[model samples]
Structure formats: structure tokens, C-alpha cells
Target: MAWGPQSTPDYRFGRSKNTQRYSAPPGVTLLGYASPEGAGDAIHHYLRDHEAQVRRGQQVVRAVQQLINQGITPDITVTHPAWGEALFLKTLLPKAHHIQYCEFYYQNQGADIDFDPEYPSSIDGHYRSLCRNATQLLSLTQTDACISPTQWQCSRYPIEYQHKIKVVHEGVNTLFLTHKHWPTKSLRCSIILLILLTWAKRHAKRLLNASTSKPLPYPSGLI
Candidate 1:
């Protein structure tokens, strides 16, 4: 069974709303929660109420346990950020393989500078601590695989976890790239060419209409 953060109705960044619409692989079931829009508020709330975080985590764990209790033995349990930490702590799926998506790091790295404006230092610290905890837990757990979009993030993980981590570079959907060989052209290049062609056609039509508006003066014999 598939156990992970299913998509919600909201248009949250990096998460698609149609996540649950699709069917899962055989013997797999998708799980999800009604999540808030941004991490900032959630992080702030968790910091102020540590017990609340634990309670929230417990709820998630119970949900997964319920699935297992119902004879749905999922082959894998996948998770992101906070949910991943909660699942790791609960150890509910001792038999199932654990897979996590390493989305980002909260440390004071250069990349975090812009984000600091939205997530203050306090929130950043809390997030970092949580991430570190999650990383350690994942390291100890017998997870089958760790998926990451970037090689840099794959490198940030501990050497032990690194071995299990796989770098699956994100790619466009095959359906969208109908031209099998067009992958050679970057998405930006395709978009630019389309825009240029559209503009040229539009302007060419305008020019044609303008020229036709008035019969060319003179040229008596040229119809």
C-alpha cells in the first residue's frame, strides 16, 4: 500500500491538488491530510506548542497504524518534511519500506537568505532542528530508498543515508513532450520559439491587412 501525503484541494506550492485523483499501484493505498498553505505558520505553531506537535504527530501515526490494522500491509511509506519525522518516530510501519523526499534544508545556507524574510531566525532554528532530527531518524531506520530532486540535497544527507538515496532528476511529463526527440530542446527554447512564431504571425497579418486597406496608387496596369 502507498502511504504518503496525498494532495489537497488547496493550491499550495510544490503540491498538486489532483494528487489523489490518480490510482495507485496494486496493493497500495494513498493517504493524505488537510495541510495548511505555508510552512511558516505551522513551524511557528509547533515551536510555541511542542506538545501540540507531538499530538499532531500521534494522529498521523495512528492513521497509518489503522491502515496496517485493516490488513493493508503497505510495501512502502513515503513522506515529506514534518510527516516524515512523525512517521519515523512512531515506527508504525516496521515491516514496510520507508521512502522520503528531501525537499529542502532550513539551515543558514546562502539559499536561505531570501527565505529568511518570510521565515524568521526563530522559525529557521526550529525547522533546522526538526530536519536534523528527521535526518538522524531516517539514518537509523531501515528505509529502502530516499528520493531527491537535486544532487546538492542528496549530498547534504549523512553518508549512510546517502547510499540509499537516489537522484531522480525531475522531468517533464512524456505526454506534454510528444516529440520524443524534442527533449534535446530545452523547455525555455521551445517556449521562446512558440512566442516568436505567434508574434510574427500576428504582425504579419496586421501588415497584410494594412497593405490591402488601400489599393496601391499608380501602377495603372498592375491589378
Candidate 2:
């Protein structure tokens, strides 16, 4: 069971393309969210009213609940930290193992604070506060497993939660990089062909000039 942004092409390219191809073990089931209307509108509606968003999230969790209600217990359910707050898997998924893939905790802890200069201070402050609250909620949760791509990210969690955190290095495939050399070879071939064409053009021009300047051959009968 995986929760977070739904699996789309962009997210697939960003997050899982290489790993899925190279590192993922056989028989791994990648469960992702699917909304009837799609995730964009749902996320937009979620951001507007957090309380309503929490309710809606609970409804989403209930769908998972139905699977468990039918006695199908998944081995692991990985969720993004953003969706962690809305999902109460401890209560909802008591038997199944819950894991969270920690990304960033949104707050003003020395991170850049670039915003629209035209916006009033009050609006900025409200937005900042909302971000802080979301981060706070993410940090407070307890789960069976937590994984981070880097050690630095794993350190961001609370000391108690750190024991549960595991550092898994994301894998990379060199196949694409190797395939890139073929294009470079192709480019070099193209350059060489262009140079040869230029030389041929010059040679043809010289032959044409030489032929035009040379004396014409006389007819043997007239001579």
C-alpha cells in the first residue's frame, strides 16, 4: 500500500522510473491512489479547507479500510509525509505495517522565503503559519517503518522516530547514460559528413572554374 500523489507519468519519471526498472524486487505491488475526478482538483479542494480535507482524507482511508475489512493484510503501506497527517493508519490499519517515505518538512527553518512582493505581510504570515502546522503534524506521527533516500533527511525526524527510520539509497541505471554515447557518435558522424560535403563542393567549384578557363577542343575534320 502506497499513499501520496497518484502515480502519473511525471511522478513516475521523477521518483520511480529507474528504480522500478533496475532495483525493485519481483512480486512488489505498487498500490497508488486513483480518484474518479483525479488528484489535482482533490488537492486544490484539500488546500482550501483543511478540516474538510481531513474528512475527505478519512474517506480515502476508508477505501483502504474496505480492503482490510475483507481480510487482505498488506505487508507494508508506504505513504508520503504530506499525506501522513490525513491518514490515520495506526487506527485504521492496525494489522498492516505502515511506513512513510520522509521528504521535506515544510517550515521556515532557514529555508528560502521568496514570495510575491505585492502580497501583504498578513497573507505571508498566514501562509507560513499553515506550513508550520502541517510540518508539526507530520513530525508528531508514529509509524512502524520510516525510510529516507538520504541520511540528512532521516535526521530531520524526531529522535524517537529516528530509530524507526531506515536509509535506503535510491538506485540509478547507467543504461541511459551509456545509450547517450550513441547520439554523440551520431553527432560526430554528422559533423564529418558535413565537412566531406563542403570539401566536395569546393572541389566541384574548382573543376568548373578550370573547365571554363581551358581552351576548347577543335573538330578534327575542320583541322
lDDT of each candidate versus the true structure = 0.49, 0.48
lDDT of 2 by residue, 1-223 (tens): 4432323111111122324444333444333333222235545432533443354456546656665586654445556655433356566656656677765444333222223243223556557545544533542474677787777666755576778778985644466547555553322222211212212353555434544565535322110
- As for candidate 2, its clashing pairs are none
Once superposed on the true structure, which residue ranges of model 1 sit more than 4 Å away at CA? 1-54, 84-86, 114-142, 173-223
Question: What is the model-wide C-alpha lDDT for candidate 1?
Answer: 0.49
Clashes of 2: 0
lDDT of 1 by residue, 137-194 (tens): 5333545677887687677655766787789877556777687655664343222222
Each prediction's RMSD to truth:
14.3, 19.5
| TM-score for each of the candidates | 0.49, 0.48
Tell me the deviation in Å of residue 123 in model 1.
12
Pairs with backbone N, CA or C atoms under 3 Å apart (clashes), candidate 1: 1-28, 1-74, 2-29
Best lDDT goes to which candidate?
Answer: 1
